[model samples]
Target: MSHPALAFSEAEYRVRISRAREQLVARGMDALLCFAQESHYYLTGYDGGGYVFFQCLVLTAEEKPLTLLCRRPDVSQARDTSLIDEIRIWLNAEDTDPANQLRGILSDLGFAGGRVGIELDTYGLTGKNHAAIQAAMDGFCTLVDGSDIVSSLRLVKSETELDYIRKAAALADDAYDSALDTARAGVVDAEVTAAIMTTTLRGGGDVSPAGPLVNSGSRAIYGRGVGGPRPLDAQDLLILEYAGTFRRYNCCIERSISIGGPTEAQRKLHGLVRETLEEMQTAFRPGDTLGTVDDIHRRRLDAAGHAEHRFAACGYSLGATYRPSWMDVPPMIYSGNPLVLEPGMVFFPHVMVGDPETRLAMGLGNTVLVTETGCEVMSRHSLDLPVR
Candidate 1:
């Protein structure tokens, strides 16, 4: 049978795997059991929605073949998308113990008494499954948290990955245009959302993990609001935060639109947001610490007298992701984070300001790549609030 088309070449995956193996060896780990779908895809080109169930990819330092422990339903998925030749299926019976099955697989692969790395902080591994695995591996192997081992490798983007991200960014710009065109007086929030989705999909964008949040009126005050059936009024504020994906690589954009001419207060907030985003671009140069960029944002907001309206984190890493959230990796733009900026790292710096008392929300943000000198904004949408 033919294998599914891979997003990257076999050489690229080999480099990724080599980096991961090096990290594992440095940490004294003999093998890595990855539960996160991102890690699976990054390592073996496996792409599927079956990660909601229990699935794991076992990567060993030794020349033994890589193995995948997945449910029967994902067997074809693994065969089709992954380069892994050894696949094991676990039955979902009430009395069946898949953890023990996994333990057996490890033992058969000569990892019975080795230091095995496991992704302990992922949703892919539930509490029940973790407990079962721990019980099964007791005295047989030593399990250690290796979540950052693979995740840290994904922080920097390759040129091929950046090309996909650029395509996703173009789609995000189109989605923003659609949102602006659909968001007007008397239009229902759902209609606007449908338009955004249509534009995104029609433009060859993949499904995003988070949202195309189309919050209007008071709901806009909440940062995490979603689209609803409510119709927009003649004088309403609409906050739109959405993303576009290409081969699971995501580029997100957030902008606020005014149904009518924006009020003076709305304009002020929008202006401040725009200014903060511009400052962020200047602050995102290589060699700068994540904390320094965050400090710049906070200082600018405080200087503008909008400290009370600032968001907790100005931005976070972005990349190929599965459900739960689109945010990726570490170094979230927050105070005290010591992660230094590096080239090839992509992030979305969103300048969000909301006043609950006034029920006003205004935001402007864009996906950016940290470059040798400064940064390059991926999404090309205007920073100014679009007045519909």
Candidate 2:
């Protein structure tokens, strides 16, 4: 199906609602109130303005009609397409509080001072919005951190969700191809970055998680930023990582290409990361917990003589929309969280452990999905180091 046509279909919305209801019961909650962008998209098909405009969904545990709150600008879309219990609008100024609007809706929906589970992890209720919500509740509502429940609900990926992710991966792969086709001696960092961005847009990509990591050489290897640019030398490492959004689903990937000849150290280190990643892929069974997989990555890194390097920046959850802003996490870096590997959980496994002393960044990641037997690597670009 064409992306534009299937991006927001009603048929897909039912799948999300059904999945969320299962999670709601498991969390032992009466309702799942999602004010975060990613959560909203996961539950309902409201990806308008992503998390910026503050669209929200309130899913009851009983599978009753869901409540949807939208900004005035998005009210029409919510009414037309959403399977919401009651649709309401909350007018929000740049710095004004949106409390009364929030409270009034919750109050009208009978969510008074009870166990109102909410996904308020990322500053959703911390500023003027918090104050408004607090005042509106008037000690009637008890807001609790809902990340655990929300994460549990979204742990497994749906086939439709995978389709969006695959589309995103294809777009990012295009950026990688574009970067290689145009890379050469003396190209500036900005030029390379621009090429990736333009190529992504032309290939039908939307906004990525944090834009393209167009850093080359040393910059590209690290998990944080791109490498330094000195144009492309002969066989120089051209590290490229980027993703484009289709609807709110994001597909991200990173690949390295040598301009002329690959250095022995670069080849060795890149291979090490790849080999280690492959090992992790081998152990990624459907029943393994995220915590266990994280250990597997760290142990592999330590065994490879990266014990001194902290395995801190190596994972992200890939799903409905590009994290709705960087807070969406990769699943491997969990701590005691027992989220099981399912048939459709997509994770951005970015295995990295870089030290500043060497100024060399070496890591690899591709949005992967867990299947019934094992996991599948969505990215196919080869990051082969040089024979030299």
TM-score of each model, paired residue for residue: 0.97, 0.84
Error of 1 at 366 (Å): 0.6
Alpha carbon lDDT of residue 29, candidate 1?
A: 93
lDDT of 2 by residue, 66-140 (tens): 777777777666555445557766666676445566666667667676666776665343465555665666777
In angstroms, the error of model 1 at 261 is 1.2
Best-fitting candidate, measured by TM-score?
1
Q: Candidate 2, which ten residues in sequence have the lowest lDDT sum?
A: 1-10
Query: Which ranges in model 1 have alpha carbons more than 4 Å from their true place?
Result: 1-4
What value of lDDT does candidate 2 attain over all alpha carbons?
0.66
C-alpha-based local distance difference test score of model 1: 0.86
